[model samples]
Target chain A: GESVGLHLPTLSVQEGDNSIINCAYSNSASDYFIWYKQESGKGPQFIIDIRSNMDKRQGQRVTVLLNKTVKHLSLQIAATQPGDSAVYFCAERIDTGFQKLVFGTGTRLLVSP
Target chain B: NAGVTQTPKFRILKIGQSMTLQCTQDMNHNYMYWYRQDPGMGLKLIYYSVGAGITDKGEVPNGYNVSRSTTEDFPLRLELAAPSQTSVYFCASSPRGRFQPQHFGDGTRLSIL
Candidate 1:
């Protein structure tokens, strides 16, 4: 079965440092990707997104990089803050008409002050 | 803006019980989705709606049913609930196509014993 998996289950970083999370997808048809942040006992909040046509998209302090050649995606957070400590998930949309989005297992990010 | 709202923040049900999880969005988004998240597991798509009257199954739709009577509402019903169905359920909406980032509700935590 095709699946999207993260390279790490947990990440620990110091506050004010940069953070990077990676995801690999087996589905080649995935044309759109997104990054979300989920705090404890809360729903996922959208971070940033990128289309297959582009290699990178930047948000306020977040940047999403897509490497379609290897079906890899990464999210970079500048000046990681304590509030950024949460689980991050990468999701992809394989079929445009279906409006379907599938998520990865997630990576727990812990930022220590 | 209360982009998305879910009712019954937490619920506990006995085996064989039935209930519906309510989801509403203020953005009047045309795309709505239902997803379930188990402990230490990735989010799984339960069902989705492209528009007010169009609905479809997702990755994990066997034990759930959804109805989208209006663009603002999409409810998920669970009949004869089992322990396996116990998980945190989230409802999300997006303004654009499948490629758009989703706005999610706080989520409903369901426990079936």
Candidate 2:
């Protein structure tokens, strides 16, 4: 079955440094992609999203880059902070009719102060 | 605005016990979805509702049921709970558009013994 996966299970970075997380998706039919941040004992929070038509989208200090040809997606965060320590997930909209999303295992980002 | 709210932040159930995880959104979103996340893994869709009186199953719907009687509410029911059902459940809602982002609730932590 088609699935979404992250290249790294965990990423470590120092404060004020730039951070990038990579994700790979198997479904070519997916048109929309999203990034979510989940803190300890909490739900996933919406971060940024990009559509197939657009190769990149930026929001606040975060940017989402999509490469349809490679079926790859990446999220870049600027000036990493301690509060940014959490699990990040990338999800793809698999079903357009009902807008179903398939999520990646997740990449835990640890920002050291 | 209480984007999305889930009841019973935590719960414990014995094998064969049944319970419902309640979810409601104040955003008036037309699309509601339920997902379960196992430790260290991504979320798997359990079920979703397009609108009132409309419901459908997703990737992992077995042993679980759902209903949407109104636009503001979508509850997930787990019957004959088993150890496999132990996970963190999250409810999310999105607007009418396919490209809209889904807003999530805090989540319900369930442990089945």
Candidate 3:
């Protein structure tokens, strides 16, 4: 079964530090990827996204790096804040049409002030 | 903008009961999706709609059903509910594109007893 998965289930970091979350995917046909943040008792919020054509994309304080060679993805958050504490998931789009995403298990980011 | 809204924030159902989870998006996005999240796990797609009158099953759609009558609404129905169906359900919408980010609703917490 082709699937996307996280390298770590949980990551703890101190405020003001940088945090990186990794994901590995098995589907080579996937062309698009996204990162989502889910807080306690809430739905997932879109953070950043990257296409297979590009190696990286940056948001406000977040960056998504894609390595098509190894089928790996990573999300980097600079100056990690307490609000960044949540479960982060990496999702991949299997096709070029309508964009149905396959989500990974998730990595819980714990930021302590 | 009330991007995406889901009704019945919480629900408790007995075995064999049936109910529909309402999802509406004011963003007028053409792509809608339904996903379920279990405790300590990431979200799994249940169903998705590319546009009005077009629907498709996702990763986990065996025990769920969905319909897309219009671009603004996509509801999920659960018939003969089982305990395994208990999870937090989220509705999301996104523009038509290859890598568009999805806007999600708060979620409906369902408990099957």
TM-score of chain A of each: 0.91, 0.92, 0.91
Better of 1 and 2 by lDDT: 2
Query: In candidate 1, residue A24 scores what lDDT?
Result: 87
lDDT of 1 at A48: 90
Q: Which regions of candidate 2 fall more than 4 Å away from where they truly are?
A: A1-8
- Clash pairs, model 1 backbone: none
For all the predictions, what are the DockQ values? 0.58, 0.58, 0.56
Model 2 chain B worst lDDT run, 10 consecutive residues: B36-45
**What is the Å distance of residue B61 in model 1 from its true position?**
1.5
Model 3 regions lying over 4 Å from their true place = A1-8
Q: Compose the digit string of candidate 1's lDDT tens values, residues A1-113.
A: 13334343789999999999998876888888889999999999999989999999999999999998999999999999999999998988878566677788888999999
CAPRI verdict (incorrect, acceptable, medium, high) for model 1? medium
Error (Å) of candidate 2 at residue A81 is: 0.6
- Candidate 2, position A78, lDDT: 100
Better by TM-score, candidate 3 or 1? 1
Interface RMSD of each: 3.7, 3.5, 3.9
Give the per-residue lDDT of model 2 (tens digit) for B1-113.
98999999999999999999999999989999999988767788999999999999888999999999999999999989999999999999999887888889999999999
Backbone clashes counted, model 2: 0
